[model samples]
Target: MNRLLCGLAANPALPPELVDRLIALAATPPGPSDLPDPAGLSADYLADLLVRNLSERADLGPAQVAALAALDEDTPAQLAHSGHLGAGDVDPAVWPLAALALLDEGRGLPEWARRFAADPDPSLRQRLASCAGLPADVEDTLAADADPEVTAELAWSTTSAPVAARLARHPHAEVRQSVAGNEAVPPASLAALLTGHGLPPARSCLVCDGREIPFAHDPSFQDVDRDLPAGAGCDGTHGSTVHGTWARALSNPAAPPEAVAGFAGHPSVWLRLAVAEHPGLPAEVYARLAGDPAPRVRAAVARNPGTGPEVSRVLAADPEVDVRRAVAHHPRVPFDVLGQLTPTTRLGPHPLPPISAATPEELARGAASGNGRVRMLVAHRHDLPPELRDRLAADPDASVAKAVAPHPGLSPERLRAMVALHGQQVLARVAANPDAPGDLLAELARHEPSARRALREIASHPNATAEALLPCLADGKSRVRAAAHPALPAAVVVGLLADPDPEVVEAAAGNPSLPPAVMAQLLP
Candidate 1:
C-alpha cells in the first residue's frame, strides 16, 4: 500500500478517479511504525526525490498537483521535522519543484522557495504562483505581479480571497477569465468585472488590421469581402469587436445583483438586451427596462424570464413585430396573447439567439412550421416528437437531417441503415447512442475504418464492449485512444500506460482495473 501510494504520487498521468482514491488513502491512518524511515536517509533527500518525481517525465501535470494539494496539509511539515530533512539540504536547482511538493502537501515552502517567491524571474514567480496554499503574503505579492502570466496563474491557483481581489482588475482578458473562474473571487469584484460595458477602442483593430489596398488611391479601411460593393467603407461593415464583458460576467451564476444593475442603463442595445435576461433581477428594474425605446431591448424584455405577465401584456400589444413575437413565444404570456399573433409575425432580429429553453409543445409547433428555419429551430430541441423527428430525418434539407440524425429515438435498424446512407456525418452520433445494441456497435467498431470522430464516439460509448474497444486502442486519434482506456482490460491498460501519446497514457493510468502490481511498479 505504501509503495502504491508513493507510486500514485509520482505518476502525474493518473486519471481523476484514481487521484481521488489516492487522496482518500493518504488520509487513512497508518500505524506510527508503518511510516518507514529508512536508516541514514536524509529528509531533504526525500523531499528532493518527491519534487523530482513531480516533473513532466513523471506525469506531474497540473491535475496531479491540484489533487495532491487537497490532501492533509501536514505531510510537508511532518517530513521536514522527521530528522531526515535539514535546512539547506535541498538542491537549489529544484527549488521550484520543492515549492510544488510543499504546496501539494498544503504547507508553505521552506527557506529556498520563500526566498525566491518574489524573484524577478517571471518563470520563478509563475512557479510559485502555481503552488496552492502558499503563504497569504507570498500569494498576494504574486497576484500583483506586473507579468500577466504570473498574475493569471495566481488567479487560477490561489484560494486566498485577497489575492483574487487584488488581481480582479487585471488588464488582460485571459487574467480576468482566470480570476472569474476562481470560486474564492468576491461577489462585488465579480460583479464589477461582469457588468456589460464597452471600453475605449484599442490601438489596433483585428477587422481593420490587414486590408489590401485596391489601388494607391483607394480610400477604404474595410475587411476584404467580395460580397460587398467595392469601396463600401468599413463603416457599417463588421460590428463592434469589443469584448462582451457583460455577457462573460452574466455567464457566471455567482454574479451579484449590483454588478448586473450596473449594465441596466448601458447605451449598447445588445448589452441592454443581455441585462433584460439576467436571472432574479429586481421587478422594478425589469419594469423600467421593459419600456426601453430600443425594439431589441423591448424584445429582450418580452422574452426575459423575469418579465411579469403585466409587462408581457404591454409587449404583446407592441407595434414592433419582433417585440410582439418575443411576447407571443414567452412562456409567461397568456394563451390569448399567443392566439392574437399571426404566423406572419416576425421572430425578432435576424439570426435570433435562443431567448429561453422551449417546452415540448413549442418544439412540436416549431417542427410543424412550413418555414425551414422554424423547423431547423425544432431540430435543436431535445424532446422532439417521434413523428416530427422521423419526418425531419427524411427532410431533403441536409441541415435538418444532420440535426435529427443524432436522435437516440431512431431504431437500431434505422440507425444501421442510416450509417450506410448518410455516411460519416451521422455515423458519429449513431455510434454515441447508448441504446445501440452491443452487436451493432461491435460491427461498426470493426468495419468502420473511417471517420476518426465516429471512432472516438464509439470508443467512449457506455455500451461499447471489450471487442468494440480493442480496435480503438490502436486508433490514430489520441481522443479515441483515451476514450478506449476505461473499457480496456487490466493487462491491456498496463501496456497502454507507456503509450506514446500523453493523453492516452493519462487515460491508461486512470483505468480502474489497473493491477495492484502494475501500480506499485510506477512508484519511485
Candidate 2:
C-alpha cells in the first residue's frame, strides 16, 4: 500500500473510511519503487502509520512523552487516549481548546467557554469569542482581545453593550462591522463608522448617505443595458449612470428628508436615476421618478429597493417594457409581484451577476439556472454538498466539468471518471497543476499516450522543442522513437546512427555527437 494510506492507518484518531482505503493501498502491486518519495508521505509506510495513527500505549502514564516514545501500540486504551495529548510534547496540531469545546457540548456551555477563554493559546481564545452569552466582563475582555477575530466577535454580540461601544474603533475591518451593526452605537459613535468608510460591516439594510449598508458592492459595473457596454462613461447626458452612482452613495436608508427630495429633480437624468434607485429613498421620490419623462429614469425607479411592495404593484403595471423588466428582477419585489411579471421576458440583455446565495432554497434553485457561467459557478461552490458535486460532474458542459475537476474534494474514482469521460484536454489541465500528484501523472500516461506527449511538452526546457522529444530516448513507449532523441546526450545519438527508422538514422547522422565509427554506420 501507499505510504499516505499507511500513515492514516497508523493514526488512531483517523476515520474508518481512511483506514479502509489504507488497507486497499497495501494491496496495489508496488510500483517499480523508482518513484521519488512524495512530500505528503515522506516517512516510510509503517513508521508513518504508527506516528500518524498514534499508538494508544503512549497515552497511558506518560507525563514524560520522551520516555513513552519507546512504548508500543498495545499499551492500554485510557493510556492511549490521554497519552495522545497529555504526552506534553504532542504535535501542536492537536488543539487542546477545540477538543475541550467538543467535550463541553452536552454540558454547561458558559463554564466551558470561560475555562477555555483563559487558555494560553490565542487561537483557542479566538474560538471561544464566538461562544457568545458570556458575562459582560468576559465579553469586554474578548472585545479588546488582541486577536482581531476575537475582538470582532465581541463587537458583534448584541448582549454585550460595553464591548460594542469600544469596538467602533477596532483596527480590524470585521470588528468595525460588528460595531456598526450594533443598533445601540450611541449616535456619537455613528460618525466613527462614517469616517471608517464602511470597512467591514459590509452588509445591512441601511442606505443613507453616510451609513454603509452591508452586502452592497459598487454596482457601477453591472450591465443594466445591453446596448451600453460595461464601464462606458456617459457624456453628462446618461441619466442612468449619474443616478446609479449617486443613489448607491446614500449611507442612511431614510435620508435627511430634504437631501432626499432635491435629488429626484436634478437636471441630469443620471442624478434623477440615482435618487430613484436609492434603496433608502422614501415613497415621495419613487412617485416623482415613476412619471419621469426619461423612460430609463422610470426603469431605475422600478428597480429601486426603497420602493415597497405596495408601490411595486403600481410600477409593474407601467406600459414600458424596460420598467416592467426592472421591477421583475429587483430583490425587494415581493413574490406576488414576481408572479405578475412572470410572463414578461425583460431580463435585461446583459447577464446579471450570479444571484446572492440568500437561502438554501436559492442555492438549490441556482443549480438549475440555464446560464453557463451561473451553472459553472454553482458547480464549484466549496460548500456544494456531495450530491450537488456529483450533479456537476454529470453536467454535460465540459466547461463545468473543467471547473469542478481541480477540487481535491472529489474522490479519486470520480477524478479518474472525469479524466476518462472528458478526454485528453481535461487531463492536460490536471497535469499542469503543480499540486497534482505524480501518481496521477503516471496514471494518465498509462491511460493515454497523448497526455504523456502533452505533459512531456510542458516539462521541456527552452532548448527543447514543444514536442518533448528528449525523454523518449529512455521512455518505455518504443513509439517515442530514436529521433525523439532529446537535444543532448551525445553518446545516445552516436548509438542511434544505425537505428532502423530513417528519421532516427537521419537525425543521429546529422548530430555532431556521432563519432567517426557511428558516422560510418549511417553512410552507404
Candidate 3:
C-alpha cells in the first residue's frame, strides 16, 4: 500500500483516482517518523521524474505542486545540470515550479540560473532575475542586457543608482515606468525628469524613510529656534514645515549651492551641521562653517575630508578639544600640525613621558610608583623594560593587571604565567585581550565552565581553539553557546541544531558554514 501511494505521488500523469489519493496524503497530519518523503524516490530518480513531468504537459494540481516544492534544495540544481530545464527544453507551464525549487534564499543567483538571465523566454528570465542581494557583477550584466524585458527587472529590483539612472532613460516605456515608480530613484533624478517635462515640483515629499510625505511644504516657513522651546518645531512630528525641508535637503544629493549656502546660516544647528558635512560644499562655504558658533558644526567642518588644509590648521587650534581632535585624525593635516596637537592619551591625568625626556629606566621607576594612575600610565608605554612588564603583570590591582594584559610587548610565557596567577576578574581581561597568545587562550579554555563570564569571552576569542569552545556548547548559559556557535566546525553545529535551547538552535542556524543537509533539518 505504501509503495502504491509513493508511486502515485511521483507520477504526475497517473489516473484521476491516484492523483486524488496523493492530494489526500498531503492533507493528512503526518506522524513524527511518518513524514512524507516529498518525492518517495531517491534525489536522482526524482530529478528525472520532474524533467519528464514538464516535458509532457500532464495535469498536476496544487497538491502535486506542494509535493514538488518539498524536494531538497539541491534537487533543482541537479535537474538543471542534467539538461532538462535551462536549454530551452522544459515546458513553459512548469517554469514556476523550477524557479521556486531553485530560489537561492538570500544566497546569490544559483549557478544554473545565470544562463537564463537572457533566456529567450521572457517569463523565465523575469522569474529568475531578482534584485534582492544579487551580486554586483551579475547585476551589472543583467542591467545591460539587450532585452528590454530583462533590463526592466533591473529598474525595479536593483539598488544601484547608476543602473536606475540608465533604466530611467531606457527607450522602452515599460522600463521607464518602472524607474519612475521606483523609490530607489534619487531625488535629483526625479527633480530633473519632472522639470524636463515642465511639470510642477512634487508637492509630496519622498524623504521620510523613502515614503511619500503626505503634507505640503508650509508656505509661511519659520525656522525653529536654536534653543527649541517646547513644541515649537518639527519635534520629530511628521507635518512640521521645518521637518519637511530637513528631510528633503538631506536626501537631495544634488541640492543646489544656493540652498546649501542658505542652510549654513539656518537657525537650527542640525540643518547647519548637515550643510557642514555635505561633501559638495564649496571650499569658501567650508571656511565659513569652520567658525560657526555651534561647536558641532565646527567639528563637522574639521572632520570633512574635503576641508582645505588651512581650514584644518585653524581647526587644530580651535578652542573646542573635540574639534582639535578631529583635525588631529584628518588625513590632509601635516605631520607637524598633528604633533603639535595634544596627544589624546588618557591613561592618567599627566601626559605620557616622552621618549626624548624619559629613559626606559625612568619609565620603569614610574611603573613601580605606588600611585595606581602613574603605574597605569607606565603600563601603556611600549618602551617598558621586559622586567617591568612582568612586574605589572603580577600587579595586585585589577586595573593595572588588565592594562598590562593587552600590551603586545608582553611575551607569551609571561601571559600564560599571569593567567595562572590572576583571579577570574583578571582572567576575563586576558581572554578578551587581542594580543593574548594561543597557548594561554587554550589554557583559559580548560578553566572551569563555572566561570561563565570568562568562558563567554573565551568562546569569542579568535585564538581560542575548537577544543576550548567544545565544552561551552553545553554551557548552561545561552550566551556562551551563542558565542561558541560561529567558531565550531560543521559537524559540531549539526549536533547543536537539536539543542534543547531555542537560542542555541538559533545561533547554530546563523552559522553560514552549516551544511545543507543540516540546514534542511532546521527548516521550519
Candidate 4:
C-alpha cells in the first residue's frame, strides 16, 4: 500500500487535488495491522518520506508548504532546513518555529529580517541585530531601537558606514564605545573621540568601573595611559579610558592625517607606531619618522604611501632587512631604487598604487623588466597601453598572462588566443572580465568540466547569454550563480526552485525572471 502511494506521488501527471489528498493521507496515523508483511514498511516512516519528497518539489507553493508544516511537529523545521520556505509560505501559527529554525541556521532572508526588526520582543530584535548583511532600512530601524543592547549589538557588527556614523553618537556610552571600536566608523568620529570632543560627558569612569580615584592611583594603570591628558577619556578621566579609545581611533585606516599627526610627537610608542602605519601621514612626518630610533616605526614609514623618494632611498639602505624590504614594495619607491633592493622577498597580494599615479614611461619600464613580478604588477593596471597589454598577455610567465587576461582592453581575438595557449589557466580571468564578449563567454562555458571557476564567473557575468547559463545549472559548483543569473529562462529558474542545494533554491526564488505572481506568493 505504501509503495502504491509513493508511486502515485511520484507521477507527474497526477492532478493537484489528488496530490492534496495524498498529503492528507500521509499526515493521518495508520491503524494497527494484523498481518506481518515480508518487507517491513511502517506507515509513519512512509509518511515522513512522503512529506520529504513533497517538500522537495519545485512546484510546492505557499499553500502546500503550509500544509506540509502542519503534518507533524518536526515538519516545520524540516521545511525550514529545505531552504524553500519564503516569508509567505509558512502558516502564521508555525512562523515562530520556522523563523527560529531559519535564524538558528543563519539562513534568515531579508523579508523575514524586515518583519523581525519590528517585532515587539526585544529578544527577537536583539537576535536580528547580530545578523550580518542586514538590509539598509532594517539597519536604520534597528539603529534607532529603544533598547540600548540592540543598538549596541548593531553598532558592533555593522559594516555600513552611515549606520556606524549614526551609532557613533548613540546616547548610551556602551553603544558609542562599540562604534568607536568598530573598524568601519568614519574618520571624523574617531578623530573626535581621540581629541575628547564628540562624546557626551558621563559621571562614572568607563575604564575603571566609574572609580573616582585619579588614574595614577589605579593599580592597573600602564605606562601607555600616563601621557593621555586629563578629560581626554570618554567623559573625563573618570568616565572612559582615554588612551584605549585613542589607540583604537588612531589605528583606524580612516583616521584623519591632521589628527594622526597630532600624535606623531606623543610620548607613547604605541601611538607613534599607529601614526607611522597610517597611509595618509604627512610627508614631513614620514621623513621625521624615517629617522626615528625605533626600527618598526621606520619600517612602517618605509611602507607608507606618503613616504617620499628621499625617505625611501634612506630606508632602502637601512641596516634593518625588514625596512629595506618594505621600501622595495613601496609604490613611491623609485624604479632604480626598487631594482637595487633584494628580489628574494615574496610579494604580497596587496593592491598596487592607482594606475592614475603611474606615468606611461614608468609603466613601460615595469613591463620591460626581466622580473615577472614587475610585469605582473604592471598588468594589474587597467589603463595599460595596447602594446604593453599585448606584451604582458604573451609573456612566458603564466601568472603574468593570467593577470593581463582580465584587462578590458584585450580584444576578443586576443582573449581566445590566450585561452587556446594557456588553456584553463586563464579561462577564469577571461570569464570574470566585465567587457568579455558574450560570444567568448558562451564558448568558454562549453568547457564546463575543466573550467569550473570560469563557469561560476560566466553565470554572474552581465554578458552571459541564456546559452552560457543553461549548462551551468547542471553543475553544482556554479548552480547558485546560474540560478541567480538574469539571463536564466523562467522555466529553468522554476526548476531550480527545487534544487537540492538550499542556497541555489534561494537564489532561484529571488531571480528577477520568476513571475510577479510567483514572487507575490513568496513574499510576506
Best by TM-score: 4
Candidate 1 lDDT over 106-184, as tens digits, reads 5444555566675778877787777666776677677667776778788877887777766666655546656776768
The number of the candidate with the highest lDDT is 4
My TM-score estimates for the predictions, one after another, are 0.42, 0.32, 0.43, 0.53
Q: Give all candidate RMSDs, comma-separated.
A: 15.0, 19.0, 13.9, 12.2
Q: What is the alpha-carbon lDDT of model 4 when measured against the actual structure?
A: 0.72
Per-model CA lDDT versus the true structure: 0.59, 0.50, 0.56, 0.72
Report the error of model 3 at residue 58, Å: 32
Candidate 4, superposed: residue stretches over 4 Å from native: 1-203, 207-240, 248-270, 278-299, 310-331, 337-342, 345-351, 354-356, 474-477, 515-524
| Deviating ranges (above 4 Å) for candidate 1 | 1-275, 278-303, 306-365, 369-373, 390-398, 446-449, 474-484
Better of 1 and 3 by TM-score: 3
lDDT of 2 at 74: 24
The list of candidate 2 runs beyond 4 A from truth reads: 1-97, 100-112, 169-174, 182-192, 195-281, 285-306, 309-326, 329-343, 346-524
lDDT of 1 at 316: 79
Cα lDDT tens digits for candidate 3, 201-226: 22221112223434233435442422
| Candidate 2 lDDT by residue in tens digits, 268-306 | 675576567656666877877788999898887777766
Give one clash count per candidate, in the order shown.
Answer: 6, 34, 0, 4
